[model samples]
Target: MLSLLATLWLAAAPTKDAEPPVPRPPPPECLSSQGRTVCGYQCRSTGTHADCARTPYGVCQVLTGRVHCWDPPRVVIHHPPRSSARPECKESRGNVACGYNCRLSQGEVACNSTPYGVCSTHFGRLVCWDPPESVIHQYGARTPQPRCLNASEAVACGYDCKAQRAEVQCASTPDGVCRLDNQRFTCFDPPSLLHCDHSAPPPAD
Candidate 1:
């Protein structure tokens, strides 16, 4: 009976529950060429294999053997044409004059209005000038002006002027005037002398 009791006691004793073994993570796979290690489902080298990262908008796939991040879908926007008043244009003397706002002269488009002043292609985009005065005054009498300069003198009335050691160089134009390099005096009409002292200083104020 004691033996039977001992067996019963052994059976009745409470058994401690055995703890479950912790899961071991798999070893990381190293990509020798890219020098990166990846584990599980992450990007791993399959020898020139391409992979992609998924996102809500789009998937970014590997390009040129490089891993790219998630990318969104591209959106294209269309713009309407710019609106402006139709230019009043006319052809005259092989040039197209487009109202007072712009003109097409010598195969170039020129606009005249700007915040600072009027603009013309002849002066380039950087050059601007005040608008011409609307009023005109007539003088009682006009005088004939000369166009030539003295020897060895430089004058730049309309264009560039340079004076060398023995000669004076002036730009030739039909409506050009003569003014010394010093800018002391301006000859609206051409001067009689084409040569003058280019080195002369400005006259007294």
Candidate 2:
């Protein structure tokens, strides 16, 4: 048989992972609804007694004839402050522009549209460039940049290379070179440079 003092001591003993008891508010007045008397905070009333948790996910119950309540630790919430700076704007002749680093000059509005881009008016058209990008003009698009071939030594680059035994010749245009007679190592460019034999086999009828 356990003594009353031993029982009290056992009840007061701190167990492993024991949660701290929550302080409950006094029993609120019972409310009679649907022929039933509901008591305690949020229906946690136990036989003329009441117990409830103050924090989130808290619970209360009767254990060993005593109202016990436990609650998770209180949590604090932090929020970032709102920004007060307004958006940049530029207005011209009833027209409005909104963005960063806005500009209104010569009846035109320009903004720093792209990252690291400096916007400007080119021929009355707003143009932005920084990390370079391709821009095709409406009229007279820029001719593609010539891709010239480079070599350490002489690089004969063309489709007009004509070889004749000990002689090598080439023409400027692709369909320019006709025949490289096994005679002269001549490189022709159009206006009929070297005189050749005018004689030819008669056309067969």
Measured over all alpha carbons after superposition, the RMSD of each candidate to the real structure, in angstroms, is 33.5, 36.7
Give stretches of model 1 more than 4 Å off.
34-41, 45-65, 68-205
- Deviation (Å) of 127 in candidate 2: 2.0
| Candidate 1 least-lDDT 10 residues | 132-141
Error of 1 at 190 (Å): 93
Over 1-205, each residue of candidate 2 has an lDDT whose tens digit, in order, gives 4698899999999989977565443444444444556444433554555554443233455544444544322110011012221224455665555433456777776544222223544344554322212211111112121111222322232235555443444444333453556565456444423332322221111
Judging by lDDT against the true structure, name the best candidate: 2
Report clashes for each candidate as comma-separated counts: 15, 0
Candidate 1 at residue 196, lDDT?
26
Tell me the spans in candidate 2 whose CA falls farther than 4 Å from its real position. Answer: 1-87, 129-205
